[model samples]
Target: MNMNMDWYRIFWHTAKLGNLTRAAQELHITQPSVSYAIKQLEAQLEVKLFDRLSKGVKLTSEGMEVFKYVEKSFTTLQSGEDRLQKLKELSAGELRIGASGPIIKHFVLPLLDTYHAEYPEVRIRLSQGKTSDIRERLKTGQIDVGIVHFPFADHELTVQHLANIQDCFVVGHAYQHLSQKPLTAHELSNLPLLLLSEGSSTRKYVDQWFSSQGIQADADMELSSMDMLIELAGRGYGAAFVTQSFVKQELAEGKLFQLHTKEPISPRAVGFAARRDSTLSIAATRFTELLQ
Candidate 1:
């Protein structure tokens, strides 16, 4: 019927208080205004909603029936508003995130720890995958934010640079002598090279770096996991290309040694991305702010 909601609001308070004056006081309106609204409502519904009494007013049988649904609808609306406030405050909500395993562990974990500590009521959903996979999830609305290797280019996403990452070749005791001096790209390529498997952003960057130096990076061992590559490289399998920050412990402990190249490897970056068209949930926004 497209009736005015103000009429029903006045009716609810009036029915509850059983006094038009009190309803008007609660609504911050004149008693005559309350009476006029009630009259309009009754006329629209084509029913007597209240019985005028000397003391106050009483709901008619028809008014009681209509009140039931009105009460439920208003209650539901109030509940929705309360939940939205909680979400806005970051006291309750879900944060859906996606990233590669290594980035999640080395880059995103500390930020998550801070976020969780502050907003313990927020539900965190973390999905581990390649950068490409993370982007796909963002596109499909499966994830609210994505942590990926940059410079990531996607017209559909708004990306913010989080941190810089340096990729270098690491080796074990078997190749200890090679780390003594900066080797040429040809010399480095000729050594038994270990690398992350194809289809990863890191792998693509490494391949491009080698190509730019006029060398072909032929991996003696290709693996899907950076940890596996590090493990294999540490066991003296071959020199592995990996993020420098991720192998700090091993480097400090002399388990894995960083190799120097005659040509410096270009440093890349890590960034978080979200769909440009969608608004991030409060929890996600706060988490990203913490990361920043």
Candidate 2:
């Protein structure tokens, strides 16, 4: 129990070489030191480790058994060190990310593309869920990083501001009149609206905004995916409240029109999250830098 690692290290080298003089040379120590270390090791382990021979030395039966474990342990230690070095250099590893559906579509996809191009060896795994779900994953070390919508608490996470997002009501060309002129809260209320389900942070934010303006917001249709909202809005199903960034394609192509509101929606942000106390993996840190 009083033995230290140096004795095992010396014994490992001495046993591997099977020559005390050669082991001493590899260890940059003298022959007596090698002899002394092997004696210390055999005494500590309570076994005869080597048999002296005319040429040099050879393992005893017990020595060979212990060498098997010692050899495997050294090999594993070396492999671990090599793996750690590779990770530090960003050469190999997987990056697990947590994101919501809309954020992935609008923001994370392009970032992933660029990250892959730069570090092709890094594997990216993405899990999509709501902001709260993503945060839970980040807290539990299930994911390396998360790009999520914010109005979130700063308790367990380190938040990095990524982009400002504007939410607005949009409709297809069938509702042309709603495009040019800003509508009052009461006027907006009268229109058939498509909204995300209550569990979503977007839904909560929009609901709070409407309540602050003294109007109770209700949706004629509720859907989970933002892409679905955009598509249905394009087909003139109803005015759907969506992040403007996600709909730049539909807006530019004249498929969807952004509605002007008398009470304009204030912009929010998409932020990235990592656990506050833990260090980010090299792959995750590289991806975050790419976003910056």
Candidate 3:
């Protein structure tokens, strides 16, 4: 049967109120229109939807089954509208973020602290992964935004430069003598170099740096964890290539010392990334704006 939505809406209202007059008042229509809609729906469905009563009407057995589906549909639609309203007012929604662990700890956490203080009602979700993995998540609509350390030039993502961070070779008090003099590429290569493993973007950046200087500082040890790298470097296991900002406490406490390089490693950027063509949700957009 060719059924109309208007007729079903009216039938839903009439069934809920159990009175044509009350349905008309709620739907902002006349009583005759409400009655006509009910008649049309009943005729189209080829079943009696309501039984006439002295004061009002009540649903028939068949009508009760129809009403069940209609009630669920309208309730879900109304819930969607309510959620949209809350989102528009910034009182409800979720913000999904993807980031590397170091970026989260050193950079994203402070911004999140302020964001939470301002929009405490908004739910925050965080996922940890490498830059490549986060980029894949964004492209697939798994996360809303990401903060990563990498080369900003890319076709796969819409990225914004967030902060300039300097990567350096750091050592501990056991190797403090290296800090006294600025070492050249050859000089730095001679020292035991602790490098992050091959898969990471940070390690790739460091690898390219070495390549640019016409050398490969052979890794005395290759590590995957920045924490362990820092810890071992602090104990003078070797000079670890890491971000300068991440070791401020160690530097100030004299546990680790920053190695000066003659061939300076240029500053790299921390980037905020999202899908190239995807539209971010209201909460995600607002949180991303803070980084701008």
Between 1 and 3, whose TM-score is larger?
1
Residues 40-97, candidate 3: write the lDDT tens digits.
8888999999999999999999999999999998899999999999998789999999
Instruction: Name the candidate, 1 or 3, with the larger lDDT value.
Output: 1
- Cα error, residue 110 of model 1, in Å, equals 0.3
- Name the top lDDT candidate: 1
User: Worst ten-residue run, lDDT, model 1?
Assistant: 282-291
- lDDT string for model 2 (196-286, tens) is 9888889998898889889997899999899999899999888999999789888998889999988878999888889999988788888
Q: How close to the true structure is residue 179 of candidate 3, measured as C-alpha lDDT?
A: 97
* Clashes by residue pair, model 3: none
lDDT of all predictions, in order shown?
Answer: 0.92, 0.88, 0.89
The residue-by-residue lDDT of candidate 1 on 174-248, one tens digit each, is 999999999888998898989988989989998998899888879898888899999999999989999999999
Instruction: Tell how far residue 275 is off in model 3, in angstroms.
Output: 1.8
Off by over 4 Å in 3: 1-3, 82-94, 115-124
In model 1, the runs with Cα more than 4 Å from the true position are none
lDDT of 2 at 9: 85
Instruction: Please report how far candidate 3 places residue 125 from its true position, in Å.
Output: 4.0
lDDT of 2: 0.88
